[model samples]
Target chain A: MGKYLSFSIIAIKHGYKNKGETIARFAFYGIILLVFSSLWNAVGSEKIGLKPRDMIWYLAMTEWIVLSYPLIHTAIQEDIRTGNVAYLLTRPIPYIWVKFFEGMGTLLLRMLILAFAGFGFAYFITGGLPTNPLGLLLYFPVGIFASMVVTLYQSIIGLFSFWLQDATPIYWIFSKCNFILGGMMLPLDIYPEWLQKIAMLTPFSSFLYLPVKACLELDASLLLEALIKLTVWAVIGLIAMQLIYLRGVKKLNVNGG
Target chain B: MNLKNNYEFFTHLLKINLKSLTSLRGAFLLQATFMIINNLVFFTMWWVFFKKFKSIKGWEITDLCALYGVVAFVFGVSVIFFGGVRSLAKMIDGGDLDVYLTQPKNTLFYASSSQSHASGWGDVVSGIILLWFSGYLTFGSLPLMLTVLFCSFVVFVCIGILFNSLAFWMGPMDSLARQFYDFVVTFSIYPQVIFSQFLKMILFTVIPGGFIGHLPVSLLREFSWSNLGFLVVGSAGFFILSVVVFNRGLKKYESGNRFIGVGTN
Candidate 1:
């Protein structure tokens, strides 16, 4: 635990040395959320009659998906390109656990920082704040579970680099596919009935929407459904990741150090 | 007599570069993947935007797709053909110019061409798909569509050179170029209508983002002489400026500088 924690923290510290680019990325995302939040707030009031409190709920709930989602791309790309996977393999800790936890650690810090920034930006723009204390209570666990779903999905794709030489193109395909299914771009609830049915079969929605729904509506029946869905997807993700890891390691004679 | 030799030298240089990348499969494949990913991301961004607004500033899915398609196709071609532009600073800094300069070729031509980005090649495919989709929706004549695509090709070269010449003055340019690419890409995903007057001017004259997709796209939407004029002039000006800047930077290069090497600089 100590070793993996230190590894994850040190990676962040090393990465922070070149803080300008990352700061810009965080700011870029912040700008997108701000622009959309302001637009949606006005549109919601004018068109859909959603209240300010509901706006805040949307903002807070989507935070995990927006911030941590990019990390899914970055973590996978970096680990493969830098050959850091080999370093993790050298560690005494089980490679999968180390990767899983280290990813959690890095993403946790990124999500917290970006979420706070997104919240501040959303608040100033919309003058909206979460209405319910229970939404606040459920937010943390939902965030953790959502992030886990993202990390696992991303790492599985990243590890494919061992076989394919470069995984970004494929990752792009899957990640965009995730945007539709995961409800990262738009809520599954809003999708057409057919699309919604298809979306449910995929685990992407479990990554972003389930958490957001839990936080925003405080919909108890929906929460129960989300929990079940999350558990099932998490298990499937674990199985898939295991198969990917085994295949990737066997094919790991890639030329670059 | 020397001029004749210089022409021969450039031909030989092109032949060599063509040979080099032909054998480098891994890098090419990786580059192709990166380009495809970029295309997918924009597809998502636009899909969601179109979903939310029903329309953004009088634009539809077809319009956005056209803009994205042109940008993607143009940018992909630029990257594939001018890949070395992204590496200009590092190549200059690391004294790698020794390799290019010693060959009896125009250093600029040799440097710019045969820098194929594999990922961009993949993007080219997706770009074609989007372009075809948009054209099928809006364009009535196939020949006219082909003519505009050719203009878009010119925009590709012009904007690429304009952006690449920045490696002359910028530091650690890989990231700078990346930021530039990101900025161009993000804004390009939307209709140009929402841009303020000042920004619209910047896009038209300075950055030539207008020509990159907007002008030709407008033509596709509604044939207009003014839009074509904007496209032609903007592309010509930026293309000229970038070449001049690159030549100016080339003169300042100290080909064998050791300080810019790993240990010293």
Candidate 2:
């Protein structure tokens, strides 16, 4: 655990070193918020139950989780593809946890940076913040846990490289699932009841919808429920990763040295 | 090379790319099929949106479908045929241009067309299906669709090259190039009616997202020779600009002697 904490600290430092990429990401994040806010405003926020301000804030929260997602899957894929996983397995620490901690480190930095930048952009675009300040405060832990689950899922996809020729397509489908069922763009409240029910059944909602919902309104019961569900999903994800990693390593084939 | 020779070489390059792509038949099929499914899943959000609101700013669900169709089709064509366009920045930064430079052909086209992304086929197929279902594709409009698709494809290629070429002036800025690429694609999928006039101006000019997404969809929605003419002129201008930019940047090229895949397979 101490080593993992060290890994996260090191990753945060590494993220700080990459200032240019971070700046570019923030620029893109701002642009996307601007575009989506314009669309919502054009649609007339009154038509929907929510205000344009809330929607902008919701999008900011969701996009923060998504944009901050470290491509740990790609790293894992490359490691497996280039036969570096064999060398990695020789290390004292578990490779999967190390990658997850590194991702958490990067995700923490991104979430922190984007939290400030996203808030500024959303506030500028919508001219206000979410009405519930406590909910806004709660978003940090919820968002981090949500992103950690996403990291685990990404690792699971990367581990599939043991059997599949490429795991990118799998990642694509997972991301789109996050977009649709996870309610990345619009809140699931507006979705049809049937779709919302289906979304709840999947772990996708725990990724974005639940976290952003915390910011929409302050409800202690709802936040507690969301945390429980997210915790459940995280446990499931970790179990799945362990199973996949164990099976995958058994079938590993190295091409060069 | 003359026009005819260039055409023949490009066709040959595409054939070789396709052959290599198909060599891994299972992976190719899986990637393409997954992408088609992935795109459809993405559309579900819009589908839900339209289900509730019906339409926004005179843009119906069908119009959005057509918009996505055109954008997907053009994107697929560009990436599948000119896969290297996306990686041009990395190639430039890694000094991977030596292979293209040593080739006895148009270096730009050769560099851009050396690889194929299998997922593009999924996009192409899904795009065609979306257009058909959206009622935007009919025998009378096939010619217009093809023309607009060609123009959109040209703009997409030009954007990739122009941004990737920035590596010449600034060293190894692939992430920045990728951001621009994503910005255009992100801006292109939304209805143009949603943008403010200021943003619209930026869309049509600085980022040129409008060329790849809006103008083409507008022409398809309501046919007009003037709009078509404008698209043609715009695409041509961009094409010329991309060529000039790439050539100017080539002068600053330094070889890192990196080991890059040269399409030998």
Candidate 3:
């Protein structure tokens, strides 16, 4: 626990040092929020069932999840390719746990910065806050769980670098799946029934769609269901990461790393 | 350099890029395939959107398809033909400009044409497919559509060069450059009528998203001599401006005292 806390501090420092990049990213997110606000305001009507404000705020939540996650895949892929994982393995701490805490440190800071930026922009455009501010405050823990699921999934994808010469194309596919199925661009409920059903079945929905949906609507039953699904997905992702790491490390050892 | 010499150099670079990509045949194919599928997944969002709302403002699903098709094609052509534009920030920041500077050819052209992106072929393919699927492809409209697409291609590449050239002055502006590039891309695929009058003005001039996203669709759907003129002039103006900015920025590059290396000797 102490080691993880120390690693988290290091990651926080790293995040702080890259303030320029963070500001640029904030600008990007803000611009995207503005564009979406204009789009939703223009298109949203009585028939669409979503208010412009709600839709924009929902997008804020979703985009936060998409943009704020640590680029764990790149880190893992680089370590594997350059044989840095060999040196990392010699450390007293376990590699995956170290990465987890490091990722948490960066992810928390990014989430807060981007959320504030996005929410501020949404408020400026819509002239109001989320309908359920209390629910939103409550949704923070659920959001953290969702982030863990996404990070663990990324770790699994990154570990594939040991076998694949380049895991980027694979990660691209995974990201696209997360974008479409995860409801980063639109609410899953807005999708066709068949597509919505398919999306809900996937872990992508638990990673992004469920958490955002829970926050926006703030239904007690929905929140509970989303939490349960997120927990299940988190467990599955952790198991997958552990299994992949074990195999990847064994392969690296056999290759004389 | 003369047009003939430029053409020869581009073809030479294309040949080498193709060779390097084909060397890793499986990875190349997989990358292209994934890119195409990725595009299709994005398209699905629009599919669901139109299914729900039917149309946004005056734009319908068919219009959305055309927008995506044109934007993707323009982006693909820029990357496939002038792949080096995407790497401009990294090259400039890393002091890798020394080689291009020393070369006798046009530095910007050399820098942009030095690499090829295999996934761009996927975009080109999917873009054509989308255009055909959208029912906008007709014998009567083909010529005009081609011209507009060409203009869009010019504007896209110019915008990329314009943004990436920031590295020359600011030093190591990869993230900022990429975000601006992404801004152009994200806004270019949406319906332009959604933007307020002020935002529309900015889009037309500063970001130039209006040229590639809105104007082409308008000109294609309803022939407008004024819009067509704007498209042509705007493309030319932006292209010239990009060249000027890149040349000016080149003067600021400090080389960082790094060893200059080109392709394997």
Candidate 4:
């Protein structure tokens, strides 16, 4: 509908107006990563074998991935906490679609500001970026698609609020577990072998670590397979998400706050 | 000037914070979860590095765990007692100082002690587990009695106070300041074994990152009476400095004098 399209545009405009926040968030990430990069580089430099540049490049990719964190977590949590979620049900637009799109709009701004800036700034700092420019360029779209996979996951988590008094405890346990399994703080390779193998099969790493690995690693024999697996996960996640929205709407006190 | 009044005031503050926090169990737990997730992530990094290097700059994974226990224990204690450390910028900017000032207790005491975090208990528990695990894994659990534990807790509170004081003047965007504090934590997460001498200096004295986790690492490596003394003096000094700065800032504060909590009319 025309209203839906216009609403999304307004959200983007409102979100991007805080340009200083975007810059500050990037700088925040930069300060943390720079210190971390230097430490890792020094650790690597007392070399068993790995190069400082490898640490630099790995951190650079992780920086961008972290900046492009999926928005579904914040979006769902905000709606549940503020109880403004009731506002969406009476409107002409679909509640799930509007929230999903609004989250995407904010996420788009993050990608442009943090991810794009990180890639550029990282290159300047380390003297080289991702080895495959074309593959990396292709990563942008795949990254967007992967975030939606996570949006579905978040929606499922948020849906529990409708039935439970408070979902935060549950959310915490799950998110913390996901953090280690998803490579939010460090790469999946860092986990013990059993955990690493387990993390690979799950969709959490698909959301953050895989794409970073795809673009950052110069080896291309596995790139096509990575994209294909991502596409498959995207389809499965979106379907489950739509089902959750439908079921969640049936339980809402749509006319009440 | 009266001991009884001060004791009564502190008790009353503790009761209020306990009542507010116990009712909202989930929210309080969520805060601690974030802290725990942060620490666990760092641990994972050390696990990976130790796997390959075996002994990084003469520091093993257990040494890293020892470092973790100090930072975690200190950070956990601060969140429990000095809850206002995170609330400084918002309280100042939003003019919420009016309520605390009008209340018949010390404003700084009220701010720091009047809050509770249930989730912080998780970090405290995790800190214990990590400490227990780290010691058992490393040196078969030596004699670290009550005195050392008390001094370590003091050191944590001092670091937190020092960092929070920086927010008094940083205005509304104190997240940048908080990140810098986290930056200190991140830098200190790794073993100091591989650090350049210059980096070690920056950690030990400049940013005081070494004082946080690195000192505990050294203590774990070689416990001495001197380290205990350092913690006592360092923590006391940091706390004194924080209180001094806070009182000085109060002379310059401009209150917003309005409620900014959820659904404030």
Candidate 5:
């Protein structure tokens, strides 16, 4: 636990050191927010019961969730490709734990930076934050759990690199699934009934939609349901990651990587 | 180079790129397949949106489909023909300009066309399907549609080169360059009516997302000679600007002491 905490602290320092890249990324996020705010303002005016400010706030939260997660798959894939995974295995701590802690550290810092920037953008555009401040505060833990679930899923995709020469296409497909089914651009409530039903059944919604919805609306029942679903999904993701990791390591040992 | 020589060089580069891409047929097919699915899923979001709201500011499901088709087709054509535009920042930052400098050919043209992406075929297929399904594929509109597509392709490639050329001055700015490219592409897929006047102005001039994505679709939907002329002139201007920028940036490029053997792959 202490080792993992230390890893997280080191990763946070690394993120702080890379302030230039973070600032550039934050600027890009601001542009994206500006575009989306304009889009929602225009579209919401046409649609019934759609408030542009609320939708923009929802988008701010969802985009923060999307951008907060580090691209752990890319690092893992590179390690496997370049035979660095063998060196990683020799470390005192388990490779997966190291990755998880480092990823968490980076993700926490990035989330704060992006969330602050995103909220500031939203406030500047919409002139206020969401009305449900308590809900927003409560959403931090749920968001963290959701990020872990996504990380585990990405780790599974990365583990596939042990077998496939290039797992980029597979990762692309997974990301598209998250973008569409997860409702990154728009809330799932706005989707058709059938599409909403399908999306709700998938774990993708738990990643962005559920968290954003909780932040904006603060529905106790909905939050409870989302928490339960997210917990289940996180467990499933962890099991999948562990299974894949074991098989990948076995293959690597046999192949002398 | 002369026009004829340039045409011949482009064709030769296209052939090499295509051959290299097809060298691994299975991987190519997988990539193309996944890209098609990815695009279809993206379209589904709009499909769902239109199903609920019917239309936003006179832009219907079919219009959105056409918008997607045009943007996807333009993007596909650019990546397929001049895929290296996608990696221009990385190349510039890695000092990969050494080989291009040694050659007598135009550096920007050669660098931009040096690679081809197989997934572009998926986009082309999905885009044509969307255009046809949206009833944009009429005999009367075919010429106009093709013209819009060609102009959009020019604008797309120009935007890519313009952004990626920043690496020559900013060092290895892979993420920043990519985000700008992605921003342009994302803004292009939406209806032009969604933007306010200020946003619309930015789209046309600063980012030129409007010229590449919005204006082309709008021109195709309603054939206005004036708008078409604007698009033509805008695309030409952007293309010339990109070339000028690339030339200026080339003077600042310092080799990173990396040996890149030609034809090694």
Candidate 6:
């Protein structure tokens, strides 16, 4: 656990050093919020049961989770592809936990930046803060847990590199699921009842929509539900990662062996 | 190289890329399939949006479909043929341009087309499907659709090169280039009516999202010589600007510093 904490600290330092990527991410985040704000503004807040400002803020929070998600899968893919996993396995700590903590560290830093920037920009665009300040406060922990679950899923995707030539396509599908089904751009209540039901059944909404919805509605019960679902998903993701890693390492036929 | 030679070389490069991708049939299929699903998933958002609101500022679901069809197809064309555009930043930053500088062929053309994206095949298929079902595409309008698609493709490629060339001036601009490129993509899918005049100007000029996203859709809806001219001129202007920017950047490019290769496998 201490080693994991150290990995997290190292990642934060590394992220600080590589501020260029953060700026780029900020620019993209700003652009997405700006564009979507315009869309919602044009759509107007009628019959949707949420104000345009709320929708924009919702998007900002969701995008924060997505934008802050560290691409640990890419690193894992590279390690497996180049057979560097062989060297890493000999380390005292497990690779999956190391990656999780590192991703959490990176996400922590990125989430903070994107949170301040996103909220400020969304405020500027929508001309007001979220109606519920307490929900905004609750966003901190919920957002972090959401991102942690995302990191575990990314680790599972990365572990697949042992068998697959390229795991990016799988990552792409997962990402789109988070975007569309997870309600990144809009609220799930706006979706068809059937679609909303399906999205709720999956863990996608737990990471994106439900948490933001909880923030928008200022409901602690909703927040609790979001956290509970996120924990369930994270546990499932961890188990999958462990099983996949063990099986994949068995197939690890590095060169010169 | 001459025009004919450049055309022949590009075709040959494309063929080699296709053959290489098909050689790994499983990976290629998986990638293409995933990309198709990705597009559908994104489109579902709009589908759900329109289902609730009916339309946005007079733009119906079909109009959105038409807009997305062109955007997706053009994006697919750019990545499929000019896959180098995606990695131009890394190549410039890493000085991987050394290999291309020694070649007898046109550096930009060869570098851009040397690789291909198998996932773009999915986009191509989905674009056709969307356009076919949009109720706007007909035999009579097919010629115009093709023209719009070509112009949109040019805009996509030009935007890619224009952003990528920044790496030559500001070292290692992969993220910046990608984000800037996303600016165009993110703006292009929405209704043109959503933006104000000032934002529209930025989309038309700075980001050039209008050339691919707005102008083409409007022209398809109501044919106007001025709008069509704008699309053509915008594409041509960007092409010229991209070539000039890339050439200027090439002059500043330092060689052989890149430790690793930067393009597709």
Best by lDDT: 2
On the 0 to 100 scale, the lDDT of residue B13 in model 4 is 68
What is the alpha-carbon lDDT for the whole of candidate 2? 0.88
Model 5 regions more than 4 Å off: A45-50, A253-257, B258-265
Which model is ahead, 1 or 3, in terms of DockQ? 3
In model 3, the runs with Cα more than 4 Å from the true position are A253-257, B258-265
Q: Per-residue lDDT for A167-208 in model 5, tens only?
A: 777888888778888998877777777878998999999888
Model 2 stretches with alpha carbons more than 4 Å out: A253-257, B258-265
What is the DockQ (computed on Cα atoms) for candidate 3?
A: 0.78
Ten residues in sequence with the least summed lDDT for candidate 6 chain B: B256-265
Model 6 per-residue lDDT at B114? 79
Query: Per-residue lDDT tens digits of candidate 4, residues B125-237?
Result: 67766777676323443445334455556555555555655555755655554655666776666666656678778775546666677765676677787986785676567
Off by over 4 Å in 1: A34-64, A67-88, A94-102, A127-141, A253-257, B1-57, B89-98, B101-108, B136-170, B195-208, B248-265
Docking outcome class, model 3:
medium
Go through the candidates in order and give each one's DockQ: 0.25, 0.77, 0.78, 0.32, 0.58, 0.78
Model 1 earns a TM-score of: 0.79
**Residue A178 in model 6: lDDT:** 94
Q: TM-score for model 4?
A: 0.83
Number of colliding residue pairs in each model: 6, 0, 0, 4, 0, 0
Q: lDDT per residue, candidate 6, A24-53, as tens digits? A: 888888888888878877888656887787
> Each candidate's interface RMSD, rounded to one decimal?
4.2, 1.1, 1.3, 4.4, 2.1, 1.1
lDDT of the candidates, in the order given: 0.66, 0.88, 0.84, 0.65, 0.83, 0.87
Measured with C-alpha atoms, the lDDT of residue A51 in candidate 1 is 62
- Against the hidden true structure, what lDDT does model 1 obtain? 0.66
**Cα lDDT for residue A64, model 5?**
80
Q: Which wins on lDDT, candidate 2 or candidate 5?
A: 2
Model 6 Cα lDDT, one tens digit per residue, B39-61: 87888888888888888999998
Model 3 chain B poorest ten-residue lDDT run: B256-265
Alpha carbon deviation, residue B130, candidate 4 (Å): 0.5
